[model samples]
Target: MYIKPLALLLAVFLASLRLAAQTAPAGHVVVTHLDSKLLHGNPGGENPRRRVSVYLPAGYEASPSQHYPVLYYLHGFTWNDSLIFNQDGMKTLLDQAIAAGQIRPLIVVVPDEQTRFGGSWYTNSATNGPWADFTARELIAFIDKQFRTLAKPGSRGLAGHSMGGGGTVRLALAYPGTWAAVYALSPAFLGPHPSYLPGPGVGPALRATSAAEAQRVHTTLAAVSLARAFSPNPKATPFGANFPGSLGADSLARRDAVLARWVLASPLYTLPIHPAALRQLRAFAFDWGAQDEVKHIPPTCRQFSNLLAVYGIQHTAEEYEGTHGSRIMGSTGRVYQQVLPFFNKHLDFSP
Candidate 1:
């Protein structure tokens, strides 16, 4: 009896070890280096040599002719391609989801979007280069050519968190014909430029002589980064950027002009203009945490969902029980349970 019980315990321990090994694999991520023509000569001087992380599902090597639908996942502000490569338990969750047959096998791509000011926000800026174009055109073209991808809009999906979520919403709306589905998690959605202006010292901080000083003031750096994205002035001194009220003086006229441009870039403002474009999408969904640190995000997400409803555009929006950074790790099951299944249902995985 003792011998039998000991043997059973040994078997269970071995099985657990195997499961752990499968869940976290050091070799899961494949890094590809690309010399981007689109990123060349950016005023911010962000690296043109980029590293893209591609996660291949199990048996990808065995299925030589099976082309998989591609899901392009954008990381949050201050994050790079390494988010998917190492942190966040994304690979482990994906592997578990695939192994469990909860979702079909698909290719996941995470591209580096880090810029001089931390993140590009996945927007096209005179200073930051055309990130939206890079994602919708250049990156897609590169992936289809290199990987065994479905190679069509119906099989492609875009998803992101935080600033990347903002990018997902903007890019998907701007290039409705390019993506089959889109999912945004705790997106940083701005209403207007005037709404972004912070408390005192913001104006002076924007005038910082060095990148270190500018970045030290987080709120000011964020404002400046958005300015670089929306209202870049290549001739501006120091940072070579200008916002609505970067100077100590505030001008309503100048503020309004810049705010108008920002509103135009906003998904809330743009989605209403192109209701038909939104309606044509196969799937559109966004979710935010109830306790998101960005207090405005939950309300913004709700407002955006309502706008879609008003326009008669079909989409899904949800409020989950968590904070902004709560669900990113595989521990939460949001990606496996919600995100992957949404894409599975929408994206065309045939052939």
Candidate 2:
């Protein structure tokens, strides 16, 4: 009771610090590598042991009896597992959203699908690794075993951006029972488009030159990624994949075969083959920005949505007023405002 002024101030300061710590977000990220039997071999010579980012809810440690839903997020082309923490700000957004009571507490996991070519295109291949199968089978099983996941389809959600967004739809259809609700944000290459066509200067960029031409180099790398994903050649030299367009007269005779491969890879054309699989999803939603930088994305997304409607599938399709990357940035970002809420509405939180 007879405390001095200095002692009183110190007590107050300690109390404030404790309060701040309590009020701050308590959840954290765990960056680790997973050894996948499915991803064990990469013909392109990229690392086969994949990197993964896992986010545990604030009370994951405190509530041992509680099991939460698992949300599988796929990063876009040229992005690694750590990007959600950096450029996209997704890790921060998830922490804030859970702390603010905007969304349910859930586990979020993203696989580093970025290969030497830029992205794996979320496809299974001898060259790029079976990213598609690894994500659905190996990755999911590993997370459920390592963490307190609900461990069932109804309690699982899948979401992605760019190529990963396309992966969201592709995986949902390819493996219908793996996820309950799925959302695709600015899903790239939903179908065949003019952008997939080989334009001039592409070969030079693929051969690679100066870093000053980063944009071109990245574009070319992405093209090669697509080739590796959609039209791989186990016998080819270097990357063990076929370029979509004519690299030379040797590739010319097989031009239509390569082009058709990509067309069939698109989720737009694959819809008919897997309507029953998609219809099993609890919720299906996709959105694209009107001014997306990918010149063909807007049109392809439109065609994809139209085809879904034509096939009598019940889903959500949105056209927003931003660019591809714009909708997924900042506190007021669409991923926080839209994507998370979509899962919260559809995902089962029981048990």
lDDT of each: 0.79, 0.81
**What is the TM-score of each predicted model, taking all chains together?**
0.88, 0.88
Badly placed stretches (over 4 Å) of model 1 are: 1-27, 193-195, 198-201, 249-254
Worst 10 residues of 1 by lDDT: 192-201
Give the C-alpha miss distance for residue 299 in model 1, angstroms: 1.3
Give the per-residue lDDT digits (tens) of candidate 1, residues 21-99. 5764232678897778999988777788888999888778887988999999999877888866677877877877776
- For model 2, residues 163-212, the per-residue Cα lDDT tens digits are 88999999988998999999998998888776656533346444544333
Candidate 1 residue pairs in clash (backbone atoms < 3 Å): none
